[model samples]
Target: MKLSSSAYLRAAVSLCSLLAWTAGAHAESVERAPDAPNAAAPDAAETAEVSGDIIVTAQRRDEKLQSVPIAISALTSDTLSGRGVVTLSSISQVAPSLNVKSYPASGDTLSLNMRGQGIADSGQITKDGGVGLYIDGFYIARPQGVLFDVGDPERVEVLRGPQGTLYGRNTTGGAINIITKKPSGEFGGRVSATYGSRDFVRGTASIDLPAIGNIAVRGTIAYTDKPGWVKNQGGNNRYHDFGQLAGRVAARWTPSADVTVDYAYARGRVTTTPAYFVNPSFVGSLPGYVATRDQTWTALPLPESESNFVDHQLTGQFDVSDFLTIRSLSAYRGSTSHQFVNYSVALTAPTFPVGLTGQEDYRSKQYSQEFQLIGEIGDRFSYTGGLFYARETGRHDKLQDQFLIPFNRHVISTRWVEAKSTSYAAYLQGTITPPVLDDRMKLTLGARYTSDKRSATRNSLVNGNPVEVNARNSQSFENFSPAATLAMQWTPNILTYVKVSKGYKAGGSSEAAPVFANTFNPEKITSYEAGLKSQFFDNAVTFNVTAFHNVFNDLQIDFVTDPANPAVVSTINAGKAHVNGFEVDLTIKPSSNFSVRAAYSYLDPKVKQVLAPAGTIFDRLRNPASPFSVGDDVTRYFTLPFAPTNALSVSGDWTFLQFGENELSFHANYSYEDAVYTIATAGPAVRGRDLHASEPLERVDLRLTWATQLINDRRARLSFFANNVFDNRAAQFTIAGGSPLTGYVRQAAPYSEPRVLGIEANIEF
Candidate 1:
């Protein structure tokens, strides 16, 4: 599955040549529909061209996706539906250089990594992700609640490579922008229902009310319930089973031609069974290892977990003149989660009949406000300036109890953490098209100054007695991120750009067992990139390519000290790293009957140095288990976690029949990802057990649909889909636990879902 650099280049060249050949004879021009739901509808005269463009708001303005200087992947609602993308985790199949993993026990908890850059630990609330996630221009503060069902969105845009100056801090890798459908002035609604394997049932409804005077309103709701795929041999319970409900309401008012206001509210809830642990066969000689058949496992008990969140946002915009505008955005978001689990199955000695239980309660709240002024000077210069402020507060409370039934010995421990943070920033960006080279060359410059202050308090108790090894700490960080780009339009259909940018992520206190394990230094990255975007044969084909190199400094690494005390997690500042990669995206639409889309990514990442403090867990763990020596500077080379060496996706859609407004279509897609490591440092000696790298992933999805307006003046469609057609059981996560000295090394892994078949029906009126 490993591909060389030369192989990738050859593939790109071959694909481009094929596209040019297929589209060279076509002469039709296509007009794209606007991404904004409230934007003016397209004219009927421009609807039959067969080549449809996609509009994106990646640069804070509406433009064709092909015209954007940055490397971006944009998916519309119809595309998402066709691909059967239900959650954030499935986005990787369509987007290059993106990976997502979720804790099997809690579906709401997940991690998103792009180009080998992401948070090291999902359990730590203080840590921030390398990729920024935005919903309607509002940033999501935490990763736990990012996996919720998106319902239906107007479009989703994935911007790659250090969007620092515009996106602010914590976007060293990239950014994801989700834009939802706005309220329309017309009265309309849609309803959809789905049934699938594993007793899966899903229903969704959306309604738009006719405008009353200057106001319009819309509402949407979605619900899903399904049975778990993994069976529990010892009981009737199943792991990873869940039910979820989500709702959203939006309102828009245009009191005058020059001014407009918008408001939205959203809420979601999830309830699920905890994950089940499967003991590894390699450790079967140990007393704790329980042999199992297939992927089924024996569990003495099952745990329960729940999570919920609410979001509110308000926005206003005023058009002062034809070339000037002012906009403001305000938002608030809150979430709470609870989980109760039995840990003995995965962490305690089986022969001793140990019973270990733990409970966790977490809550978080965040508020943000932003204001911006956008102006255009003639046809030469365009600029935007913005100010932003955000505040966040959260608390985590956890309790653990251990019992030895044979010895009648019991122990209890509790830890509590409270944190608060405030952030401020001001940013400005401008693009200038000089009166040279027929005004085809442009220069862009941008900068942002950001300041962040954070404070936290940690408390602990042992067996009902207070422990003094806890304290309070505070820290502040400030940085200036700048960006520059030079772009040229060689022809009316070809554009090229080169960019250099800086990205920053603030440091914060850790919620570990020891009081002194409080904080880590900030992380930063400087990146350089060059790209080409082109359209050929009257816009029948589009091809884009990008090459980038990034230098990362002071990376934050999270590791566990002792599995016996599972809460003893620590964070350290690793010295430096380097990442270089190339990406290719292609789309071909020779005629109205067929289209093809393909993307590929190549990533090469290496850690340049490691600096672990003496007497720390990192230093102690590396003594004999890791490649590092005791006193030889302790530097080693390794790839970042979740970074696959190569990845690819190819999809096609064909419409074969059309009669009397009835059409039949077929879609199929294939995705492949090379093998990857799930942890920063993984080896057999480190955990006193043999460890295996993650298996390469391969998946194919297929869909068939029939559409018609034959149902009483309402549009109706029925579709059938099969995901993971080959049923590949690739592992997504791996963890090691238990005491190494006891000759007991327990390992747990969570695999991707098996094949799923479903049927869906949709109707619009």
Candidate 2:
């Protein structure tokens, strides 16, 4: 159905008004001093008072999110808890531009795609990451880090667009900054217990120590578990795999009024639950697809696997004087995972092309360190300059067995590969609050020089025996990136800004024989953006809107193994592309009893030019006068995967007085995704017939929380929250052309833990 322009305009206005009212209405009542003890913690009374300003380092300095020129979204602890955003997937429901794909084999390993750009695997041993994810200003080079649980974080700042200069390492898209809660001196904390259906149980505790001279400490721990939704069809308690244990410990020390030290350690592990392709032959093509087969089609029995992750962080800051502060950070992380699958390749039938059996083992180790000084050159200017360094090493091994290989069925073929990479960079950024214009205008500038080195080796092995290999390569490059931004506060409550920035992603080593060499070039993006932020109606509402255009060059394109080669897949440069989009966020609190938050993102992302080999699949899809000639027209054939063109989200909460101090909050969401190709393939020939297709889907979510606080102090409270209240089954993606032909599929990892009727209670003595 085509929506009229007028209807679109009306929808936009309605969404904006709803968001502005929720966040602005009660903001005036909430007043938090910067030096207040444990001020970042959740307190219903405080939240009901007023919406406080969100301080962020988007420009490499502490400034109000509304006043900063960059496009960003920061979720405070209250917002996080209220929305039940415990995992990245849940967080995506609030941030429309972000999407996280989970593999059943490795729940601990997340594949994050922001603005439709990101690595497809956690095991990928590449030096560059799509979206730079950070915790306390330290970079996380692998997607595995995004899988961690929220461990008493003060806030999470999601900066949209490239941050190549201020944030080191890989930030081709942007960055996610997680700021953990610091230790407090008031000496108090809370313990909470939660119980839900499916044997779900969770416990969390935190405590702050009394100030010792000028220093104090706080520690937090959390644990949770629940039974899975998938049943083991074969019995013997083998098929289902669910969420596992996750934990963290953090501490802070402030020995002097001007200095502070902080540290934390975290780990998470989950049993992998792999999904199988449902053959259309047995399941039919009906809207409600279901399998009719009685036995698992893969060659091997169901496989159980696991993915684990660990992280350590240390930070220190010292005030050299009244106007200068120095800071440093050190972090180390490691991850390991394994997966085994009996893949099929039939589009409509449960049939394994070569008889089905595949196993892959992956591991990675990473370390990073950074230092910076944040202070003002004078009262008119403030600056933050830093240096960063990181190293990562990983190994991947895969074994395949095709039982239907005529007489040689028992002989299994395998590929083993190892890769090591390291990266280092130094950067500087400054925000100049010029005396002119009476501090109404600011200029932000930053730059970074980064170097990446990589080496890899691949060999064929059988039964732990080495076979033959053709080639190996090692390469390195040093790149420089810079960015600038200018902003002006038209009034105390309104701000406008413009920015020009560059983004870079490093190359990697790929094992393809003929050595069908796979070497990726550094991808870069030059982006231009403009935005507006306003707070009106007595601060009862906040609204922000931004538009951006990005020019991407030498974009890295992942390669798929050429079926004929079986041992090699070559990477290629995608030439150039353009991405233009608009994002808006609103928060409104029309009255103390009602509030709402809404966000929407629309992207017109397309490939401007594609440099591909003649006749190489993609050419057929986008026929042109000359295959090598550059063009401006980008059709559906060139669209990127997981990059939905339009996204809309709405969430609201209502408090009723008749409920006797009880609060019932409900959240609902609707999303739309355009069609996209799953892979590059000769659709008909490769699949025996047409197989690949785009996944267009929509899902609704509803959550309700009922709670009451006991003890006039409100230190003790109880509430119940449920997610996926409707249990809608929607497909997020499908791995087309996988052997079993039944249209190799990967369902939208079932919204397990359905209708979680749970109760949570917290108490403090």
Candidate 3:
């Protein structure tokens, strides 16, 4: 399928008209701001505190959320703790805009999709993260960091829509900003301990030193562990144990009334995690040569089969004069994972066993330094600008069991691939707001340019003998993304905005097949969005709404030459696609004793144009040599993976003053995905059919807690939490043509955690 330039331009014009109208509507109304009952305003607290926007640097400045016209949701420390969210994957139920999927065979990597845009890596080097992740303003390019547990955080800011101008590289869907607690002058400390099912144990502690007029220090640490869930064929799933440890220290110094400085550092690591399946468990089809259940799932042999990750972050802030301030942030992240898997490949019933194992090791190191100068030079005009520089190096090595299978006496096949890459980027963004027009409107524009370089070398050897005759290749490319936003504040509590932006993913060499040796080109997206936020009924309710459309070009896709044999796969530019959606969040507090928050999202995603081999028939076949044989007629189709068309989440906490000020909270969420097809449509399908392309699912979670003062100012709480309370038989993953024993379709899933009961205690000193 092909789209002409004229048609593309007409669509762009329509998008622009929609944005303009939405912005105009927001400019006609005004509303009040939500009250922060926990902390006083910065001016009233005797400090230049952060704003109540919950999350910012949105629009490049510190402004009240009600005063900014962008759509954003924030989870503060208290919110995360109340919901039992410690990692990105766990937060999906609370944040309706994001979905995280697990990779069955690879324990070290997890795939993430947001607003219907994402790509799962298949031995490539194209840097394919659709949503950008920022830790205190530093970019994390690798997907490894997205799966780690970093413990309690100061706040998580989920900005919806394309943020290309401010955050460079592949922010086609949106961005997630994680902000850790910073040093403050207050002196105090808290420690908490918790225990639950699956041998779950967690501990967290934090301390803040009292300030002596000028300086203060803060420190934090946390730990967690969860036992295995899958049953092993040879034994219990003893190897599924996983845990994380993190620590951070920070300091803030004020030498004078006009200047201040802040610095901090943090680090963390993850222990062994279970990789229990060869493919999705519910896909209903089986590929030849795979196990029906977990076989190699057991405790590691001296921890050699465990996956681990480590990261260190540093940041600094300086008040460079009353009218201007400068801030800098930097970080280094690294991870390594190794796992041995089980597999079977023949499509025969009562699948036979094939001892299949694979190993992957990746090391990614990144450096990012950003400097920002913000100030108001005159009463009529205010401005902010920043410069960012980042450098990253990645090295990956993968080895699978197919290469070790013995073909002939004293003969073994080889399946080993390696990827190494280095990338650098520089970006700048600035926003201009005029003091005139009663400060009712602002115009912001920005752009970023990046250069990406990659090189890969693949070698196959059979029993000390070379098979592919030494294959080597390399490629590089450059990309530029630009953005613009128009916003207006009609009232203190209501604001509206419109934005247009472009998103980009780097290009790199593909290792699918030796023929053609194709190099995937850069994928780009143009997006338009309109959003509104307001507080009504005297701050009792806060509501936000957003609508957007995105057009993708030069979409990079992995094409398989032999659908029957997935080993012979390659990459190519697959034409175009589009994504349109709506999102809303509403929070209502009828009174001080009770409050409730709810969120929902609706998305319509489709493939506009997809190219493939002509007259391909994707279905089961038995013969190989004939032109119409099963192996030669493999087929391909365009479909979205892991994208739920509609999602709804509702939660709230109510407090009682009569019963020792007890607090009770409950939360639940449900997501519905329109079926998604797995890899190849025509071939040995997953689960005896094609992968679960169009399937609907439902999940529910509930938790209740009771808290009150015990003795010596100590606090005690009893809690009950149930995940997937109904034990719904929803599949967690789906894979095609993975194992011979499991058939072409395989499902290795993450069942919902069973019901759990726990007790918590916290002490203040």
Ranking by TM-score: 1, 2, 3
RMSD to the true structure for each prediction, in A, is 9.8, 10.0, 12.5
lDDT of each: 0.74, 0.63, 0.58
In model 1, how large is the Cα lDDT of residue 199? 77
Q: Best to worst by lDDT, what's the order?
A: 1, 2, 3
In Å, residue 689's CA in model 3 sits off its true spot by: 7.1
Question: Best candidate, TM-score-wise?
Answer: 1
Q: Give TM per candidate.
A: 0.88, 0.83, 0.81
Angstrom error of the Cα, residue 217, model 2: value is 3.2
Q: Give the CA lDDT, 0 to 100, for residue 654 in model 2.
A: 74
Supply candidate 3's per-residue lDDT for 749. 36
**Among these predicted structures, which one has the highest lDDT?**
1
Residue 24 CA displacement from its true place in model 2, Å: 37
lDDT of 2 by residue, 1-765 (tens): 433324433443443344334324433443334465533233222333255666766555566677778888887776776666666666677887776656534445566667767764445564455777778777777664345344676677888888777775656777787777666554555566677776666656665555555555666655555444545455322323445455566666766667778788887665555544445443443333455222233233656566677889998888899788888888988887676654433232233224456777878888888888788877777777788888888877778776653344554778877788878888887878877887799898888888888888777876557675734678898888888889899899999999898878887755543342446678888999999999999878989999999888986654443433323444566657788899989989788667787889888777666555332223333233323333422232344555667777788867654365556655555554454344432123233212344345445555555556544233455666656556544433354433211223332122223356677766642
Q: In model 3, state the lDDT of residue 765.
A: 41
